[model samples]
Target: MTKQQIWEWFANHSKQILDFLLFLALVSMGAFVKILKQVRQGAKASWKWFLAEAIVSFFVALLVYGFFDQFMQTSTLFTYVVCAWCGSFSTIFHKRMEDLLGAIFDKLKQLISEKKSL
Candidate 1:
């Protein structure tokens, strides 16, 4: 692609790119917390565990971004701040959030089935 074409493409997709970066930042923050906890407990921290938590945080951040994006446009700075706040809890809460979402999905599925039977 030409320079102008590339610039235009980046301009158009900047918001998406920023959001993706914010998601990664959020995951990083969560991973940092997990590592700290390991240090506090005097346990040897593994890069593998940090990677796993980061992966989980990525999905959690995806859900958070979707929910927020539906309401308004998010500025990069604001996104960063929000991600930092959310990330603080992500390591401990992401799994619980996933379970809760699963329960909600199950309820919705059951409701749809009942409606179809009716």
Candidate 2:
């Protein structure tokens, strides 16, 4: 691509890029709470656990945020902030998301069965 084309593309995507960066910054704020606790407790811990938690939380929060945004449209930055505020509770959010999906599937199944009956 030409310089102008690249610049145009970057300009077009700058908003999304900014939101993505914001997402990373927000999700990241809680990724190291355990490490901080470890330091406070004066327990030497391997960095691998931190890395694992960061990666896991990142993906979990991403999924939770995606599902939330899919169900309800809202400001991306605000959503990220709220998700981050939930902190280590992403597993809870994950479970809620599962329940939502399951409910939707069950509703569809009921509708299909009704149609078959008709």
Candidate 3:
């Protein structure tokens, strides 16, 4: 394709293109976290861990992206922030998300529950 054709095609699908880039970036960052941890532990860098983290990051990004698109309003910045946070730091993010969700559920359950006797 010509330069103009490529540019037009990119413009038409910019959202998909950017989202994929975000996913790859998150995967790289996530995998790199293993190196940092290993360094802290006085160990050599492990390709096995890197590959595992990258796979986890990809799946996390995919899940967040799919859910955000399906359930939330389409805001590119919000989507990017959420995907980056959760994908790059799955363990921490998962714990935090669990707490946040628990708080929300607790509030909802409290609000919907009937009053108890004294």
The candidate that achieves the highest lDDT relative to the unseen native structure: 2
Q: Under the 3 Å rule for N, CA and C atoms, how many clashes does model 3 have?
A: 0
Candidate 2 residue 67 Cα shift, in angstroms, is 2.2
lDDT of 3 by residue, 1-118 (tens): 9999999999999988987787677556654664576568776556776666667766786788778877886676677667766676775656788999999999987877745422
Cα displacement (Å) at residue 108, model 2? 28
lDDT: worst 10-residue window of model 2:
85-94
Stretches > 4 Å off in candidate 3: 1-7, 30-44, 92-118
Pairs of residues clashing in candidate 3: none
Expressed as tens digits, the lDDT of each residue in 1-118 for candidate 2 is 9999999999999998888888888888866663465567676667886776567678777766886678777778677976675655554665798999999999999999999999
lDDT of 2 at 96: 92
TM values, all candidates: 0.54, 0.64, 0.54
Ranking of candidates on lDDT, top first: 2, 3, 1
lDDT of 1 by residue, 14-99 (tens): 98888677667665776577568667878666788766666666666656666565566676566555655565557567578689
